[model samples]
Target: MSVDPEIHWPIPPKGGWTADDLDRLPNLPPHTELIDGSLVFLSPQTLFHSRAVSFFEWQLYHQAPEDLEVIREFTIDIDRRNRPEPDVIVVGETGCPDLNETRLPAASVLLAIEVVSEDSVERDREVKPAKYARAGIPHFWRVENDNGRAVIYVFEREPATGSYTSTGIFHDRLKVTRPFPIDLDLTQITAKRRVE
Candidate 1:
């Protein structure tokens, strides 16, 4: 949650934010994402959100296949107007881009995950999923906090319409085979007060 407060933002160009614009911006704090040509500065994560992300970060990293990598807060270039920074991404090692690069192409991505914050409800539920689906990302996962309990909703892409269909909904535990075999006890994820 240690984000820089100083950022000199410019008036968004008549054209929405594109990959070229992202390259031109002066280095601002991390977690800046471009959506529809506008700079979407993410709020510093809250404890609830942070714990969930950290839990998954470890889970995904250890359980992922040797050929795939699990990363967090990385941007995916969805298209001309959308580059979303997903909370957790599982991408193929060979398809992965340089780690120093800010954006990864959708083709390299196997999964896109968003852990919803109160501020991100509408965007997570609607905007991002639409963009990822349009970009043909094969899988998407949304983690929701309901009364301090985490509920994971899984989606798989529908090739015909570039949309996602609800594949599973998990609460107590997550056991899935797509995007790699993963078996996580969700109770341990949200119940912990500290990450370590």
Candidate 2:
């Protein structure tokens, strides 16, 4: 018989846990998010989730212009009550937070990407995109695993209507020109590592 370690969940302050509370809260699970003033704990990541996030992060960091930066698993300050962390974010250099910062203002985010996990399908597919568009983020990508292959659903915000318009869906490769030109081989996401 084995004993599991104890986990402590913080009590929310007066109204509820604010975006700022995430940084101050003690013993909260790693990758804890705030959605509508409530705590949203993430389930353990799967190999596909981790690989897909790494694939995009690496590709974006190498291809993005000097004015933009790629970040992984960092929260965006959507509102006082919602600070959701996207799997990968491309942010303009001017809006990049300092070394000590834990989150970025959604206004500065050029693109937000979420790699779907079994537990986060609804939030990633629906809720987060709506909020990201409302916050004026220019682009969003939701990556889903279809029978062990990655399918990328790309969306760009319509400036006139302030809603996301489906740009394109990439199955084997992702090539997009808006925000910046990026072309990546989706198969690289699961390639075996070479021992050098």
Candidate 3:
């Protein structure tokens, strides 16, 4: 009798995941926040997405009041399980830190920006806003690159419900006229593309 030695079943990895488990994963791909004990994979941002971020960053870097410091793509740890990397963050002078750390304390973040990618739209629009609001981070901005245009969503107040209720959307032609102390020209700001 000949045995079918070629037939075999692969065993899956064992056990649940924790934050420590996440730390063990390979550093090649970027990871994101999940509920209590899971890992979420972050999709890479597209060229358009990168452009929008750069444009906004340039404007804020030069135009924001000298007292406010702007940081890019830094993780803000809201809890043991929720750490989000906003595209651009405005932190008060006292709260800003040296460049050695990977995470920022929630209290230090004054404004958080998330540039929407196709793969992350739902997570950006729904999951993260709720998380930020719960953390009592005062301001949150969502930059959506959809249909060859950019739209900005500014949440003024912390959301009482699961998502931001008080919001403003600025299109390409309109100026971002609110969020005092930082005057931004939305049209000119979003027009600059990232150089290759």
Candidate 4:
């Protein structure tokens, strides 16, 4: 896996950190997230993780429509104590692009992606999905780093249940028409990532 989150300290919110407290936090970690009213400080990402995220961000920007913007390590205010920072967020042209906005609404987010790390596998796969589904995000993409390569998983929300339905898994290339046509060659990207 490219990244592995060790949950530096699984500090619970026994009247601990609130969203307001989080906002007041002087030196928030580079990529801190609030999960189920608790604080989970993720471990630093590896070089491979940075390369993969950069690759995706670059590709999304190049291939996406003019209206779409690809952002990295962006945060969304989920609840009072549950703010999640997805690895990559694809949103429509938000007018306030200049500002370093603290949070983004769910409606503005078209797709949420999480590059699976060894320590965050369950959270990325099971926990985060439920939240994204409930937030009414149309699509979700999960990239599992396997020996420097990625196995892609795509899911679409089931409107009735506010859950997801797996579209398919891609091992070679990711070809999708929804959420604005995207055609990415995973093999080539991962190969280049390994060399870096």
Candidate 5:
């Protein structure tokens, strides 16, 4: 199913959203960036997805280099037309300050990690990859919890026209160490959490 045109279409806002405009929004319901100009309701995270994100965050927090900074579900303004909040972002400590006011620049982000949920799998797997690539974000990781695995897609080279050209898929219980050096044990990361 196509996203509602009114919701997902990349239209130019009359005057664009400023930091003040973003702050004025009420905190009742959470919203997400959609193709820069529009905002859409963020779907609630499922138990499985939530657990996975927690696990990944814990691992990354302890294993990642001390100099690197990691943020969970933070928005980065890629351009005037695209703003996506990936599940996680790892960047150098210098680029992002300790304030929650501004949107991080895409160029400063070393990697963008997206944890897929049932409702957002298509967008995370397909739409976001191309978007991040076009924004020159360098690397994108897609974690599929339904199958209890993660697919690491590296955009080493940019495509001339469409999507990223140089892509690599790593499976079969491997360690991830490109964007940031970490010996991620996939099996441990995907271990089933006890159901409540």
Candidate 6:
């Protein structure tokens, strides 16, 4: 598969793409990410990925406190050369100022969640959590598809070490207290919803 030449793809500078370059890049594919000075173009999302993200987005929004906000498909500027977008982020109330904002600073993001797609398994499982932890994001969740079911791996950052420790792995339901008490039924992602 060849990239369309008409699309203006910017050449990386000497050190490779910076976090700010993402804003100026022309015709970059949606959800494009930068990792270790390299551009990562995401593959098309699968139905399972889409549904799981939506389910978590809705659940977090409803459960979050008045001072926190939930967002989906947004990037956090981790450093000069890395700005990977988590599938969902739970941010401080002031994290996003306006609807036009493209990204948030890592400090403002409280929790970053990634719903694993086949193409993003390694990154979601390993790379992203490390980046989020190093950036001082307090919490992280990795949602994996286990035989068509959602399995959430919850991690809390150890402030002393600046690393994430797995608090628990929740399959049928997710119950956590650190990041502002959240309880969700993992099975709801695959449950039927009534459309009015």
Q: What is the per-residue lDDT of model 3 for residues 1-196, given as tens digits with 9 covering 90 to 100? A: 8768875532214443434444455542564554444566677778778777887677788867788888887777777676777888888776666766666777787788988888887878888888887887788898887676777888865445534555677775434444445555566543654699
Against the true structure, candidate 4 reaches a TM-score of 0.86
The residue pairs in collision within model 1 are: 16-37, 17-37
lDDT of candidate 1 over 102-133, digit per residue (tens) = 67888888998899997889999999998888
lDDT comparing candidate 5 with the true structure: 0.67
The prediction achieving the highest lDDT against the true structure is 2
Total backbone clashes of candidate 3, pairs 3 or more residues apart or in separate chains: 0
Model 5, 27-146: lDDT tens digits are 424546645455655778876567667766777888778888878887777776567778888778876876864578887777788888777877787887877877777677777753
> Which wins on lDDT, candidate 2 or candidate 6?
2
How do all models score by TM-score?
0.90, 0.93, 0.76, 0.86, 0.75, 0.94
Model 4 lDDT tens row, 1-196: 5545744543545765665566666656767888887777788777667767777888898998988888888777666766888999888887236576777876788889898777898999999989998888899999887787778899999898889999999988899998988999887655553443
Instruction: Return the clash pairs for model 6, or none.
Output: none
Instruction: Tell me the lDDT of model 2 at 132.
Output: 95
Each model's lDDT comes to 0.86, 0.92, 0.70, 0.81, 0.67, 0.91
Give the higher-TM-score candidate: 1 or 6. Answer: 6
Tell me how many clashing residue pairs each candidate has: 2, 0, 0, 0, 0, 0
TM-score of 6: 0.94
* Candidate 1 segments whose C-alpha is farther than 4 A from its true place: 1-7, 193-196
lDDT of 6 by residue, 71-105 (tens): 99998899999999999999998898888989999
Once superposed on the true structure, which residue ranges of model 5 sit more than 4 Å away at CA?
1-20, 148-167, 190-196
